[model samples]
Target: MVEKSKELKEKEQKILSNKTQSIYALALLIGFCIVINIIFSFVNFKIDLTEEKRFTLTPSTVQMLNGLKDNIYVEVLLEGQFPAGFKRLQESTKDLLDQFRSESPYVQYRFFDPLALVTVAEKNNRIKDLAEDGIKPTNLRVMEENESTEKIIYPVAVVKFGSKSIPVNLLENSIAGFSDEEVLNQSINLLEYKIADAINKILRVQKPTIAITKGHGESKPIETQDLINTLSPFYNLKWISLDSMYTVPDDIKLIIMPNPSVKFDEKAKFVLDQFVMKGGDVMFLINRLKIDMDSLRNVRAEYVPIENDVNLEDMFFKYGVRIQPNLILDLECSKIPLVVGKLGTGAQTELFKWYYAPLLSSNSINPIVKNIDRVNAYWTSTVDTIKTKTDIKKTVLLSSSQYSRVQFAPVRINFEILRYDPDPSKFNKPNQPVAVLLEGKFPSLYENRVSPDMLKTLTDIKAEYKSSGDEAKILVVSYGKLINNLYNPTQSDYMPMGYNTFEKQLYGNKDFVINAIEYMFDEKGILAARAKEVKLRLLDTVKIKNERSFWQFINVLLPISLLGLGALFFNILRKRKFAS
Candidate 1:
């Protein structure tokens, strides 16, 4: 028995020795393989950790990925140095593209130093194309040395995924420089749209519908030209004047009422109410009070205290909105050029120009206007409390700054009118509603049961006190301009200034109007159609190169190498249990 025990111990010792040898062999094999891969690997194996789940993609991102027939390659075009924000932009894009590459086996990326590759740099036009698309870069970084400053041009990032190639210009167009974060975020935001477009090119689908209400003195389809331009790219557009000439279309998703100058008759009102009762979303751009900015010379423009505005008071009250007859005046008015030095030189004198226009900033950070910049409005009205009976959620989308007040329109204020005589205390206040979004259940206008004859009586149905037990509605707030572009706050020496051009000519107002309409419609995901600035991203080549090399060499690569070495040593020790 004792001899057998000794033999068993010896056998156990032999097994341990064999196992150790096997481990050493395995380690040597792995090390050899790793070295071989490092030497032979043409593309760096970059990993993505942004999202937990892999193989799944958002609709737009997937669409964009599928848009690649061949491999779509992205070139990071930077020169000596990138902008401050571009580094963050590059990291985020790297993370996204790394994930994108994982999902799309063909997608690839490359970094091009435009400065190093001068011949290749000047010839590239993708950066300029991106600017045309709207992704402008961040601010420029002027490098100063020996009392001399030279602007370092940053190169653009280029992407060629499959047959489709996208070049993101960063350094040029001095207004925007190295805005990779802005570009990447907008790209992520519009992931679905890009996907949709790519898929549609690869796979065709019906475009969504967008409708504007007519027949009730709403803006004509032609009048909403600017709005249509902004929307048509994303939707199949239509018009319904509601003039009793034709019935409303079945697929009419959104009904926009922009400054309906004529009152709705019994039938027209019914049409509007029925559309709402059926749970259709509505955006009302009613003129709370008729306004015409006082002319610069007159110093006293027409002022009429609106006794009643287009008979919308009661209708608005029902929806928990107070479309006050007062006007919103921001201490921050849009600067307008006046004819100075007797109107010839065009020296361009500017004043707190009220073109019924308010150049206000953004108030709420909702998804609709989350990354959107400041919004400018013209001849806008003040919107008051949105009071609903039960369980209605309300959000004030836009508001006037603390230094804002209102006066009953027609405003007596004028261009010649400089500052108030005393302290301009009344102008500055906390928060004043310029635009609001109300969501939730709304009381039905026909809750008590509609009379067949009353339905026929489209004109003059004054059912003010009637209450609907339980139907919900959404009420959007806006002054008249959201619907039309009729007013121009200027004068060419008694010529009576006007915008003969169109509503679309205005800057961001047209977009704001259309977006608000989609928010109200809230169907078929129309709002998700286009990215805010997804078309292109322009980066400064000079700044980007300097930044990328500086950051990665100093911050990223160094830290990672140290960490990796430490990990390797720790692992070796861990394997050797009792090693000193």
Candidate 2:
């Protein structure tokens, strides 16, 4: 009886000892966790395990966030049920916004479902209101249990700062020739840029002045309405007639000369030179040749291409680029509707490849054109970089594709050419540059050519005639119609720039122009965010389909089997321990 009592006391002591050890371990773990939490609370940082480091924001973005003076509110409309791809986008957006909030107290965001818990009439009214606010809805076909249902979603965000607000399209639908998943990945890559840019525009205190040169047969306000609308939020735009003004206004930091038809006089050229000398940037959208599509109103109509005598040749050569009076014909071109046959009283029309309107693309990874869609160019000319004495960094931003050929001026353009297919053998020329970006100090066009009277006028105006310009940037595009928006008579409104009505496609013209101006004006590296790339990691559907059953079986049985074996081992161990 004493031996049994001693054994019972021994077992009780062992149980008490095990309980004490477990309590100590629990206390230590809790203390360690508290210390870790305390340290992390003071030092906030995240560990991005992604191979691409996609979650890491660019330094420019961080700097912009740090300099925020006012609160930025973002209302993301991409809420509620979605496919796996869209859900990934939604999660990424939340993660990015959380990171933004962590960096700055001024950043705030919320997710909202416009149609959630609403009646049919209310949902329709909500969608209409969103549309009026420029937040268009995207129709999605969702698959559920082998049945497909249509779902409408608003994949956009409204960013507001103070009284100003702008809608940001979260999905990049302009990308072509990419899979849906890849497009979504690209859209995710651009979210930071789009959101940050909108916020920057809204919070901008001081805006630079941009002058649109008039009296040079440039595009009218109606033609370039979209461009003006796009830039008005960021810059102060004014029409400056070169013929009337003695010189470009002192406040004008940039000059956009759009498609000047008439030749520029020597006096006008002098003003432009002095403007460049004063460290002002310039974007010259020059068309060396004229090919009017309006002249081709009837079937088999023709128009002869002629040299547009804008007379900026010497100026361009001095600036390190020469726009040749030739037209680029590319195999990769946009289609135009043509009368193919007569259908009773009405004319039957068919879409034909219009080689003259070359769809311009860039292989260079320049920030202005990187990851952007093709720029639509009408009667584009070729640009060649001249070997100049000044150290000018000339970068080609847009070029024709591999199957392209250039026709010199006076080439006949007719509807008859569209009837026959273009021969590939003839289109041997490739990568002909259509746009060139020059960055350096430029010599004045009127350095020695300026008359004494002009020099006196410059001196009288208190404008120093600088023989060589200060460091500046000049973007020369051979196609002038790049910024022109089509006017629809029936709608009585101008179409958006880069929009093709027939093809229902939006080109990169608007983005390209904006990016070019932004690149020139960007003192900070904020525009660099546009070049961010997120790698696409997609599952192999074929492999999953083949091994679905195998994986399912292993996933179901492995855990149960392990649990059963563990229980059996524990029972054996317990029995052995008690077996005295």
Candidate 3:
């Protein structure tokens, strides 16, 4: 009996010892967790497993975030009930903002649905307020009970840093024949660009000034209004004439010479040369072969190519590039509505490849056009980079596809060719450069041609004629219509640049122009963020539909079955322990 008592006492002591050790171990675990939390609070670490690195921020974005000096308040208007596509967009926006917040403590954001109200009157008033604040609403087709209804929702956000605020469009709908899924995917892809641009705008201290050279047969203001609107938010746009001014304005940093139908006078050319000599950027969107499309209005669709007498070839050659006097015909072209036959008091029109309109591809990995799709070009000429005396760095930003041919000047533009299949043998030219960026100290065209007196009259009295210029940037394109928008008379409004009404698609014109300007001024690599691509991984509809029932059954009942079995096993073990 004494031995049994001793054994019971020892068992109790062992149980007490185990309880003490467990308590000590729990305390140590809590202390360890606290230490880890403290360490992590001072570290910035993340892992992105997405194939396209969608969750990984670009180095430019990271730099921008790290350099923030003020707090940014973002109010996203993509809230309330939305379809799966929109929900995905919302989640993406949230994830992006969360990343920003993690990187910098100054970034804050919230989601608010402008239409989330109890009454129609309240919603209408809210919409009016939003519109007044420059937040436009988009129509979304919401699926209801056995029906789909159109609802207006604001897919916009307002970013405020200090006293400045800029609106960001969350929806990137191309005026093209893209499905809802594709449009949503594009919007997701462009989220970073829109947000980063808004931030860049708000953070800018002073807006740069750019001159759109007029009085040289350039496109009218109405034709270029869309481009103006896009750049007005970031730059101070001015309509300047080289005919009147002896010298370029001091504030004007960039000069855009649009498609000029008239020739550039010697005086104007001298002024442009001096401007470049003084380190000014210039974009020459010119064409050598001017094919008049308006002639098609004359019952039978036909036109002829006329060589434009702009007379700037000599100046361009001095700048290390040449806009050839030829038109590019590409098999990979945009479709145009052509009349095949006549209907009752009408014409039966069908889509045909307009060989004159080359869908120029952006094959360059340059930051300006990297990852950007094809830019719509009409009657574009070939831009050839030639050997020049200056050490110019010429980067080709745009080119035609492999199936392209260059038709030299004085060639007839027959619309009848649209009816017949193009002979592949004729289109032997491959990857013809259409647009190029030149950066270097360019040799002046008026190096020896202009006398001291003539140069003095054109430039500042204190300015000496420079035979060679400082390092400058010049973008030469063989086409000019890239920035022009189509005007709808019925609506009395202008469509977006690069928008094709027939295809309901948006081209890369707007993006290309914006990126061009951005790169020209991007000292901090902010514009490089546009090149970030997020891969789209969509579930196969066929597979989903086929396995729908099985997934539904597993999702609904599997967890409950497992829980019931676990509870039954636990109950049996408890009973056995008590019975023992």
Which sequence of candidate numbers ranks them by lDDT, best first? 2, 3, 1
lDDT by residue (tens digit), candidate 3, 1-580:
9999999999899889999999999999999999999998899777888778888878878888888977999999888888888888899899889988898899999998767765988888888888887788988898799899998888888999887889998887553446777778878877877787788778988999999999989988888889988788779999988888678878989898888899889888988998998899999998887665675545364566678879899998999988888889999888888678999999999888888888887767676886455788888989999888889999999999999999887876667787678899999998899999999899999887888678666465555677889989999998877788998667769999988887777888887888898887877777766777766667999999999999998999998999999999999999997696
Output the worst ten-in-a-row residue range by lDDT, candidate 1: 492-501
- Per-candidate TM-scores read 0.62, 0.89, 0.85
TM-score of 2: 0.89
lDDT of 2 by residue, 1-580 (tens): 9999999999999999999999999999999999999999878778889886788888988999999877899999999989899998999899889988888989999998888999999999998988887679999999989999999998988999888789999998747688888888888988888888787777767898999988878998889988888788679999987777678888899999999998888778888888998899999998898656776564355677678988899989999999988889999998889777899999998888899889999988788997788998888889999987789999999999999999987777777777687899999989999999999998888777878888798789887778888999999999887889999667768889999887889988988998999898877677888888888777899999999999998999988999999999999999998895
Give the range of the ten consecutive residues with the poorest summed lDDT in model 2.
294-303
Cα deviation at 305, candidate 1, in Å, is: 5.8
Q: Each candidate: how many clashes?
A: 67, 0, 4
| Error at 525, model 1, angstroms | 6.5
Ranking by TM-score: 2, 3, 1
User: Model 1, 141-213: lDDT tens per residue?
Assistant: 5545545444434444554434544445432121122264554555445433333333333222455676666
CA-lDDT, candidates in order: 0.55, 0.88, 0.85
Q: Which one is best on lDDT?
A: 2
| Residue 408 displacement (Å), model 2 | 2.1
Question: What does the lDDT come to for candidate 2?
Answer: 0.88
Clash-forming residue pairs, model 3 = 175-504, 175-505, 176-504, 176-505
Q: How far out, in Å, is residue 389 in model 3?
A: 3.4
